[model samples]
Every structure is written in C-alpha cells, then in structure tokens.
Target: MPPSDAPAPTIRPAAPADLPVLGRLGALLVRVHHDFDPLRFIPATPETERLYAGFLGTQLQEPNVVMLVAERDGEVLGYTYAGVEGNDYMALRGPAGVLYDIVVDPAHRAQGTGRMLLEATLAELAARGAPRVVLSTAERNENAQRLFARAGFRRTMIEMTREVEGDAG
Candidate 1:
C-alpha cells in the first residue's frame, strides 16, 4: 500500500524566495498533464516553461490572488492558488473564493499533500468570510475529480470549449 501518512507539510503563502520552487512544481504539473493533449505538449519548450513561470511569479504580486506553497526540507511538494473572480456563486451571501489550481508531486500522491494544500486554502478562504468555494477541472481527470469530491466540493456547472482560427468574425 502507498504511504498514506506523511510528515505534516509546512504551508505558507508564496514569498519571493519561493519563486523558483513554485516554477518547478508548476512545470512538473504541466508536463505530467500534457500527455492528455499531445498537440499542446509537443510545442512546449523550456522557454515556454520559464515564461509561464514568470507569469505565475507576477500573479503572486496581485492583491486579488493568493498563491501558496507547501514544503519541507527546502523542497516544495505541493501548491495551490486561489483568487476572487468577482463572479462568485450568486446564492452565497457571505464571502466567496475560488481554487484556481492545486497540484502535488506524484511521488507524494496518497500521502495527503493534496489534502494539506486544499485544507489550508479553504481555511484561508473561510477566514476571509468565504461561504462558497469554486473551481473547475476537466471531467476526464478522475484523480482530481475524486480529490475535489473528497474535499466536499460538488460540480455545479459544465464548461465546454472549442478552438477557433485567428481572425474569425
């Protein structure tokens, strides 16, 4: 059986010092999930990774965003990002937050890293008066779906996407 009990992960908001580790974790998640879309994955280069990393770094500076990292021994094992999109769940009357992204190192799967990151995020949101939390992931990513479900999240919407060529009217 997989090791389900791991040393408690140290959770904290992302600081400038965490930029590199956050980039590494984000890139790893992208590479791992890219297998689901070869056309999108094939064109990704190291530069692309770095560029996106830089963007994430900047998001840390935005007041509307909260990017968190979980680490131990100088290695980041997980991270989660939350934001207030203004378009919150209408029925909720108090506060609202959205989980934009959450990921854990594959080596740490089933070790509660995802739960650690999520619980921490939810606490932060709750502290801020959030009554409704929301997020979206592809229906095909069953692992993520399961994680969300176990965290007490339920699907309220389905979003479909289509690609269009440039210069479409």
Candidate 2:
C-alpha cells in the first residue's frame, strides 16, 4: 500500500492496446524536442501521429527492445523505450544498451514516474547482458539531463552540429 497522500504508479511492459496513449505521448515528446531546437526536430504535422504509431509498433516487436509504461489508476503517466545494440565497429567495444526515449507527461511532472521508468529500463537492459548504457537529450533539455545524471549516467560524448549555408537539400 502506498501513502495516503500519494498513489503508486504501476510499471509494466507496454502492449498493443497501449498504442493510442503511446502515440499521444510520443507526439508530445516530438513537440517538446521541436520546441527545444526547431532546426533539429520536425514539428508535429498531420502525419506525425501516424509516423509515431508505426515507429512504436515496430519497436514493440523488436526482441532487443524494452518498452514500458507507468500508470496510476489505469491512466498512463509516461512511457520509455530502450534497445540493446551490438558493437560491430571499432568505436564501441561490446554490447550496449541505448535508452532511446523517455517521456513523462507535463501534468505528471515532479512525481517519480520518470525515475521509475528509467530504473526499470536499466534493469531490463542489464539483465539482457548489456555492459553499458548510453542516452542523449537535447542540449536545452535540463530536466532530462538531470534525470539521467541522477541515474548515475555520466557525460561521455558531445554532439555538435552546424548548418551549411550554401547547401540546400
């Protein structure tokens, strides 16, 4: 039993039936990214929902992927996805896990939902034999950075991008 003041969120693997909420939350994440960097992320469009649905559906089928949802009283508060990757190239040496995406609805912020989702994902990846885990967030996304840092993830790489003025694609 949880404290009387706060309810505990149920964390579990996401199912096909959860697609609708996942799509909505995915769109919210995309919008947030776009807001953080207009040049780097695409804004929500008529096709955005469809694209997110397909992406989530495909990820759910991948054996190396872990997708989880956090819900309280049957209302989904957030979700997360991670995947195991093999290092075929010289840069990375062994099998690693990538914390691909995690999003907690704005209304549900300040709760432990994000942390719960992260811990669950990390445990799943570790159980799968991934020696290390990595994740990235938008440069301006301080909240996400803080969450990752609190989870013991350290800075390992910095990605810098510049637009070529003369190149129009």
Candidate 3:
C-alpha cells in the first residue's frame, strides 16, 4: 500500500524533534518495497530501531553529513541521508558526497516525493563544497535506479559480490 496521499513536503534540514519520525521512516524503507525485507539483511529485532536512531543522531552532529526530510502538515513523508567522503579511490578530485539512504512512502511514490528528497540532498551537499554525488542500490531495484539516472546519476562501475566462509552454498 502507498501513502494516503502525496505530502506537500517542506524540504529542509531535520531537527531534534524529528528524530523519532526519522527512525520510523527508516524502518518504513524496507517495507516500501516487497523485496526489501530487513530481516533478510539484518537480524530481526527491535535493535534496528536503535541502530537507525543512532545513525540519525550522527547525521545531526556531523558537519559533513546531511540528513534531509520532506515534511508537510506536521508529518514527515520522506528523507535522504547524505555524507561526504574524501578518498583517493573515488572519481572526484576532492571530497564527494554519497546519498546513503533515500526513501519515500510507498503510497507517496511517483508523486515527486522521492525527487524532492534527492534534490534537497543534492543541494545541501553542493552547498557544502562537494564536487559530485553518488549512490548505490540493489541490482534488482529498477525503480530507484531509474530515479537516480533521471537525476543525472550515471553508471560508473558494477559491484561484484561473493559470500565467503558461510554455510555451503
């Protein structure tokens, strides 16, 4: 199910009071799409809430980290968490920002909510002197891939993965 309706999100930097909602939205992320089951990625417990809360808190305190929320009518509909990373391996000449997390209420999808969150995150990072932005999503997640591409994200490389020292596969 999607959100009741599209939120006229007032994009801005998140505040302390918004922490609780930020955590909620983070949980809702895996639920937004059927393929994103948190249990499959992490242990199933309330610990996820605590982890998300801590992450949100870090975003609030880190100067190079930007946590943006899309709220309207006193409710947060979506958010994006971005962080700048300076590394010699990256394509950017200087520090580059990576969009770590982005989620819009499933009900609010296709209503510009996701776009708004990205746009705001991009702007925030740009203002902070980031040369470029990057992000990664699951290979099966076509919806998000399209959104990122539409927003000017290009395919730079493919990430190959392998499981080691696990139960015989």
Which candidate should be chosen as best, given TM-score against the real structure? 2
| Cα distance off (Å), candidate 2, residue 65 | 0.5
Q: Which is better, 1 or 2, measured by lDDT?
A: 2
Per-residue CA lDDT of model 2 for 43-137, tens digit only, reads 99877877887789988889999999998988888999899999847545567998888998887887888999999999999999899998889
Please say which candidate is ahead in TM-score: 1 or 2. 2
C-alpha-based local distance difference test score of model 1: 0.76
Writing each residue's lDDT as its tens digit, candidate 3 over 35-141 gives: 45433344334665566766788779887899888887787778889898897455544568889899876656787889989998998899888899878786778
Candidate whose lDDT is highest: 2
lDDT, candidate 3, at 97: 87
lDDT (C-alpha) at residue 61 in model 3: 80
lDDT of 2: 0.88
lDDT of each: 0.76, 0.88, 0.78
Each candidate's TM vs. the true structure? 0.80, 0.92, 0.82
lDDT of 1 at 10: 91
